[model samples]
Target: MPTIIFVQQDGSEQRVHADVGQSVMQVAVNNQVPGILGDCGGSCSCATCHGYVEKDWAAHMPAAESYENDMLTCAMDVTDASRLTCQIIVTPELDGLVVRLPALQT
Candidate 1:
């Protein structure tokens, strides 16, 4: 399992142990973490799981898929760091990954 750190807009944080092969959105929803609704259930059909990968960790993740980029237009507070949590798969190398919750979601 990998540990994922979710940081809220207020600077509060929650650390979750995620199962490998699961999406970050699934981990957040399973743990009842706020700021990640995962309304589309990790199917990549919604932008409700929007989050920002800390700049230092961004390069550790794969580039976002084009469809994900399309959905991001529905999200708020998007930036270069923005990512849909559903598109981010948990892996051993991603242990200690840090994701920042946006102030708002679509």
Candidate 2:
């Protein structure tokens, strides 16, 4: 398992131990975390799981795929660090990964 740190907009944090094979959105949704809607499930077609990777950790992520880039473009407050949580596959290498929730996800 890998530990993931979800930082909500209010600065609250939930540090959870996640299974390596699950997506980050799955972890959040399964935990009933408020910020990530994951409305479209783990599909990259939806931006509901949009979030910003902590700046320093951005470099550790794989480059955004074309479809992910397309969906991210539809996200609110999309930034250079913006990523759809569902597209992020959790792995032991991602231990301590930080994902910052956006103000809104619909």
In terms of lDDT, the best-performing candidate is 1
Q: Which stretches of candidate 2 lie over 4 Å from their true place?
A: none
Positional deviation of 100 in candidate 1, in angstroms?
Answer: 0.4
Instruction: Give the alpha-carbon lDDT of every model.
Output: 0.93, 0.90
Residue 69 C-alpha lDDT in model 2: 94
What does candidate 1's lDDT look like per residue over 1-106, in tens digits?
Answer: 7999999989999999999999999999999989899998988888999999989988888999999999999999899999999999998989999999998777
Clash count in backbone of candidate 2: 0
Q: For model 2, how does the per-residue alpha-carbon lDDT over 1-71 read when each residue is reduced to its tens digit?
A: 79999999999999988999899999999888878999888988779999899889877879889989988
Q: What is model 2's C-alpha RMSD?
A: 0.9
Q: Which candidate is the best by TM-score?
A: 1
